[model samples]
Target: MRDRVTEAVPELVAAAVAAPSMHNAQPWRFVHHTESGVLSLYGDPDRTLPVGDPEHRGLHLGCGAGLFNLRVAAAHRGWDAVAETFPDRRDPWRLADVMLEESGTGPSDRALADLFPAVENRHTSRAPFTDEQIPPEIFDELCAAALLEGARLAVPSGWHADDLVDLVHDAELHEAASDLMQAEIIAWTRTGRAGEGPETEGVPAYAFGPRQHDVKVPVRDFGLPRNTERRATATFEERPQLAVLGTEADTPADWLRAGQAMERILLEATRDGLATSMMSQPLEWPELRSMARDPASGLGFVHMVFRLGYGPAAAATPRRPVADVLTVV
Candidate 1:
């Protein structure tokens, strides 16, 4: 069984690496013990965003996406991948452990197949979204996807949207003013890397959305400093639809769940003809984060803020191949 599963590990890691990250850092590592037929996940400390994700929330989200892919990969290979997150209290590096299970209502192999294509196609769209609203049914479907992963998806109202936007702007400005934070952003961002470069991690130039003359909602202008001028003029939409994913209890497990749900929602949206981008700026701030959650909705805490709409799919960014991220014993 070990030798048999080892053959599947490469494809599994490839699927897992397709997950999105803060700047596409792809901050995850995987090890498979062929003798035990087990796969262990580890978070790359070097890939972590210290200032942006000091609590490792973003790191967990990235890792969680990888875990979701692992499960899908297993299903594709005719095995149910059972995941036990953070199984070892003493081993902080053990993000999750995956094993083969014979029976379960796992995701369909067709869905897993679709996921790989989606993974390759899914890019954060910083481009302008049509002013047209995403249908209520689609919104509900995204909400359901989050719930499936034990999280809540909150769609804010008029006032709520304004408030959240304000918080995003505040966070962006703060990051800009702080030398330390700016340094961290610059460190993660790279123009181009040879084979694999130090700055090979963070957000790339192509992923950066167009700079707005005045952004009401606080989306980061990753184009700042390096690219003063917008690449192509985008017809900015008046009202951009935003949603947040939350959980009732905040724990390492909750963070992991939120991460998985985040990917699910993103993938579902992609399948439904939508382009998406996310920001956790407000949530990084305690007071602002609490306000970001809708009390009326009675959902859990907000883990992420996403902008969704119909737009051109942004260019696919570079990723360190599966061979670099996975090891087979």
Candidate 2:
């Protein structure tokens, strides 16, 4: 078992790091204990976004997404991964402890293994989507995907949707006025030409997509700062399809679960031939986040807002090498 785990750690970590993070920071690390066959997931403190995610909620969510991908990779390799969140209270950085066992397949294992292909294929699309309505069945599948990870997916419509859009705009105005937030975004966004430098992490200029001609959705303009390169403009969908992912309680463990759910929904959307992007701007502001939730949905705390529809797939973002984020014992 140890030998098998040793051979699989690299591939697993590779898929894990492929999971999306705030500004593509990729704030996650993996450590494998060969003797005990235990794989540990940690939050990379150095990669944190202090201004954008001061409370580290987004950090834990990113790490949780990585953890979900690790499980998918293990299932694809025919290994059963039993995972526990916050295994050590003394070490807050140690987010999860996973025990890899060689066991026979089960229904849930097969279900997770099915999403393995999407683990690498999924990319956050920032381009404009056409004004096409998603089928109700597809939304149902996405909701089930969130529920599988112990979270709720709510589709806000009518006046609620309009209110949510207003909240997103409010958050955008706040970001525009704050210099610290802008600096944080600039720090994580690279404007250099490809191959000019290592540029392994951070959202590259190529992935910024065309600038929105109108602000119908909550897409962060990474090119907002002065002196940044200008991008082509395109009109985005007027009524952007949005969904809210939430959990019953707001805690570290719930944040991690929400992250897992968020990734699962993204992968499922990718598999279904849909383009997806995230809107965390409103959620970043505590005051706006409270108002972002739908009063009719009966959800407690909303963790993420996702935009889904048919559009061009996004360019793949860069990721740090496995050696930079993994250690073996």
Candidate 3:
């Protein structure tokens, strides 16, 4: 059974690495033990954003998203995956341990297999969305998707939406002024990494979408410092549709759960004909993060802010090769 599943490790990791990360950093590494029939996921400190993500929250979230993809990919290949996060407290780097056991009860997770296609198709669209409201049923479905992953998806309205945007604006202001944060953005962004260089990671110039001239929700201008891209300014929606994925507690585990829920929501949204992007700016600031969630309810910690609507797909950012991020035993 181990030998059979060992052959699938490369392709499974291939799909897993396709998961989205902050600035396309791809901050994760995997070590699969063929003998034990298990895969261990570790956070790559070298690839992490220290200043921007000092707590390594974002890194954990990215790895969690990758873990979700791995599960989906394995399910699609007819493997039963049992995952345990934070298996060893002493080894903090070991974020998760996933056992790929041969399915005795036949292929499990056929439902998750249905989502395998969306894993690759989903991209963060920074472009303007058409001002069309999603059907009530689809909106409810999106919320349900979050619930499935032990998270809450709050779709703010009226003043709440405005307040969230204000929080984002405040977060953006802080990021711009902070030299450390700016440096991380600079390191990850490129002139044309996708088309040019042998660069396998980081967001490329083309994926920057456009300079948001007038948009309700905030879209980070990754090319603001360069000014060389000559990217055009585009008009976004008056009140852009936004959703917040939150957790009951603010911890590494919550962040991991949020990341998985986030990917589930993004893929479902894409399948429903919605373009999506994530804004973690406000969440970065401890002061502003509380305000990011619904002020009235104050239910959970805002882990990620999502922009969802109809728009062109953002260009695919480069991902690290499977070999670089995964080690097979």
Our model 1 lands, by Cα RMSD against the true structure, at: 2.5
Question: What tens-digit string does per-residue lDDT give for candidate 3 at 16-66?
Answer: 888899888898999999788889989898888887788888998899889
Clash pairs, candidate 1, are 23-203, 247-300, 247-301, 248-300
Tell me the whole-model lDDT of each prediction, alpha carbons only. 0.79, 0.90, 0.83
Better of 1 and 2 by lDDT: 2
> Please, what are the lDDT tens digits per residue for candidate 1 over residues 27-78?
8999998878889999988778777788888888888987877776677666
Candidate 2's C-alpha runs over 4 A off are: 193-198, 226-229
Q: Give each model a TM-score.
A: 0.92, 0.97, 0.94
Listed per model in order, the count of residue pairs whose N, CA or C atoms clash below 3 Å is: 4, 0, 0
Order candidates by lDDT, high to low: 2, 3, 1
Top candidate when judged by TM-score against the true structure:
2
Give the distance in Å from residue 40's predicted Cα in candidate 3 to where it truly belongs: 0.9
| Model 2 alpha-carbon miss at residue 168, Å | 1.4
Clashing pairs in 3: none
Ranking by TM-score: 2, 3, 1
Highest lDDT: give the candidate number.
2
Q: Compared to the true structure, candidate 2 yields what TM-score?
A: 0.97
